[model samples]
Target: MARNFAHGNYSHTQKKARNTGRTARDQTRRTLSQNFMVDRHAVDLMVKAAAPEGLVLEPGSGEGALTLALAEAGARVVGYEIDPRLAGQLAARTRNDPRIDVIRGDFTAARAPREPFAVVGNIPYSVTSKIVDWCLRAPDLTSATLLTQREYARKRAGDYGRWSLVTVESWPWFSWRLGDTIGRESFRPVPSVDSAILLLRRRPEPLIRGRRSYQELVELGFGGVGGSVRASLRTRYQGVDAALAAAGVPRDAVVGYVHPDQWITLWERLCG
Candidate 1:
């Protein structure tokens, strides 16, 4: 017999009904990422932290785990699922509930409605980068809660990790944080790698306010930075000079605390 999770203070009839539903899905679980959230404690914590005050968007809302919770917590939810089968399941689950809307589409290619919304998702491992980029590009998305591979979450959150180009570029617009570690057993088919949820909140405005030429400056900075770092010069001083010289950054604007990875901030400072 499979282990039974206690749903406290529930009548016998209710417990039986709930378990039956779970059992039915258990057979089809393989088709779903089916990691069907084993950690109720984590679920509660994620829901509490999200506190979706307004419209909330959930991309890759597999089987509606977080989506249903968000709606129950009084949030207005728009969930996008790439799998038609999962979308159908989600529609069935939320048919009686008016607060949730489920759509079937690829998140990267989909045109999200223009609205101020917070995003949350249990992201597919393969497209984590694209999903993060989408959230960053969506100006109206003020915050995001995402589950990703533990290593990626740690690096993005800057924990014991070197600054990356993506980090520097995104830092000006949002803050990244890793909330909790979820064990491998938490999902169906049990992936070998662990996962964690990350919270990101967008800044009210661009880190620098000026002629919208920051992108160009940043591109130039990276080229200079990359060239110097990859150069054969042994000494650190020589590399710095070479990079700055190659970049053509004005001598008067010499930056002392700059790193090769901080292209976004460096460019903004130089432009100012």
Candidate 2:
């Protein structure tokens, strides 16, 4: 007999039927990108990476695996699930657990808490960017540990030794890193690709001042005007050659090859 943690025990035939039902249900949830984490090891790894404490916000809390794990790890969790059935089930399941509050809604649309909090979840693949944007915009969000596509995580974390425009733009305020990778088999309805944990922790003190101007500089560098970052920036800043030298950036360096720290140095030299 196989035990369905979310539901209950099932015989072999019943398990087959349940799987079929899930496949059908998953068809309708394509827009939601509902891939439920079914592996306990994967759940444990996410919880460990997050090391969640105090208040935590969980997005796309399908089947309550991560939500329950987060609560067990001694954090007060507010889990948002867009699927009404899953949300209702989770709500009912955790009704007696004071630490867990299941909300049937969109996590991206939820308002940031006045007090400092952390966001942790196995988020929907389709809306990972949106949820990340929300976390970055929240003034009181101390950190976020999310399960996202491996490629997306690597890009944001600069795992491939190349920086992204968004990562550089936000680097002054948040530090991004890649955590453990979860195989596709970890999910109930296995996705085509593996997933990895993307960790973003807000800097206690921002690396730079004048965010608006710094972002503008970053934007101009990535605008692809004169090809290389050095040439592109020269169009706007007269001393760009000297600035690149000060930042240790090659005159012919591409924008994506420039590290965030180098970008900061460039900003200081050119705009400070």
Candidate 3:
């Protein structure tokens, strides 16, 4: 008992999702970091949040849990599956659906198209960082809604005073948000850890005009692990003190403690 695959109605869809969640529990593949998304609710939410404006880039399309929902949502989907078996099966299952094209390969190494797109995935935990970087670097990415490890999602969304270099580098252009959580039991194999959804929206008007240089500045500052922001940037760029003053960041502020807006202001003052 799967989705009716007809009207795409709420009850019909939910029934489909519920059935998948109940029956499709499979063992997670460690090499691929596979944790198949069995929860229908999470699938619907991910598809809606990042609703495909054009083509959607989906990696690790395990068991087509999210992929089916994505197609049902009317997205032109390009799903990448690393496992040959899964890829073959996905292609077979979706043979009649013109909206989806299942590609067999490593998505991280695949070049992104120059057209506008969005990314959605129940990401492979091991390569989450790598995948996010690829999406951030995509030329015309509108948004990315991902299902990541709960802890990773929290840290990226800055639920606490923690920020990764990629998150900092991506700050001026994209907004990160924490979405709903999926319990461990939601998957068939039931992972040891729970998962959470993460949303990233690209800014309509970039906070700063130049992207590469802005990222360089942010990395130079956040890359310093053991020193304050001003100290970290002092030797790299002249007038570091002035930039900090302009950004209202304290001379002794920890590099990680500085907010994204502060980084932007400082970069503008120094490089603008």
Q: How many clashes (backbone N, Cα, C below 3 Å) per candidate?
A: 2, 0, 1
Candidate 1 global lDDT: 0.65
TM-score to native of every candidate shown:
0.72, 0.91, 0.84
Task: Say which candidate scores most in lDDT.
Answer: 2
Across 1-272, the per-residue lDDT of candidate 2 in tens digits comes to 11122222212212222445456455546656879999999999999999999999998888999999999999999888776667778888888888998877777777889999999999989999999999999999999999999999999999999999989999999999999999999997789999999999999999998899899999999999989998889888878888898899999999999999999999998887
Cand. 1 TM to true fold: 0.72
- lDDT digits (tens) for residues 116-143 of candidate 3: 8889998888999989989988989899
Overall lDDT per candidate, in order of appearance: 0.65, 0.88, 0.79
| lDDT (Cα, tens digit) per residue for candidate 1, span 74-123 | 88988877555577788788877879888766667655558888887777
Off by over 4 Å in 1: 1-35, 210-213, 224-265
lDDT of 2: 0.88
Off by over 4 Å in 2: 1-24
Taking all chains together, the TM-score of candidate 2 against the true structure is 0.91
